[model samples]
Target: MDFYLVFTIFIFAGALIGSGLSFYVEYTKLEALESYFSENKVVCDNKRFWGRNTHIDRFYRMLLISQLLAMPKTHIKRGDVTEAELAAIPLSLKRWALWPINFGFIWFASIIIWNVWYR
Candidate 1:
């Protein structure tokens, strides 16, 4: 096998592992929040899940979700998001954003690095 092929495979594997670990961590937080919300009888406003603006800014949503999980009080103070949005973050949109985006970023970065350093 060619060295570059092997190196590329290794880089891809590392990127996949990193993405999996990252998603796993995020899923855990989502689950924890779900449990907490359930236990506390916190009712999320489901209507606001899609958000206030008609425009769907996925990047902003992702950042808002992270902020919601990491700094709930502070993020909530902004008053643009709701618990439903936080909870919905792990659903379809999130899966789309996390895996593909991370993989693409890593793949491109690795290819660029390889070209610059090896080629």
Candidate 2:
């Protein structure tokens, strides 16, 4: 098999695994996260905009919360997240929620780079 083909397969597999992990997190941990940030306006707005108790909404909610947790300082400065709320989030939850999203982002960027380099 061609090296490019093998590389593409590897990337595709990683993306799939990341997506699966995201799905798992959405179903298993999203509700706990929602309760944790229930008082935050940004999270409330996201729930309202995305609607509640649906897969797509869950996915977006997970992404939003993950972003908020990832950059507490930025979100706090923007008044989207309070320091107390950010501090309340568990470190383990942060790791579980962040890894898949981060992986997906890096994989996507690498795919772009690969395409550019080969084309």
* lDDT per residue as tens, model 2, 1-119: 98888888888898888888888999998888889898888889998999867888898988899999888899889988888987787888878888887888899997997798689
Cand. 1 TM to true fold: 0.36
CA-lDDT, candidates in order: 0.53, 0.87
State the lDDT of candidate 1 residue by residue for 1-119, as single tens digits: 99888987888787777667555544444444334334222223322363443334323434344444556566557664456656655465445435544565677788788788675
Off by over 4 Å in 1: 31-47, 50-62, 65-108, 115-119
Which regions in candidate 2 have their CA more than 4 angstroms from the true location?
Answer: none
Clashing pairs in 2: none
Error of 2 at 74 (Å): 1.0
Q: Which number leads on TM-score? A: 2
Candidates' RMSD to native:
8.8, 1.4
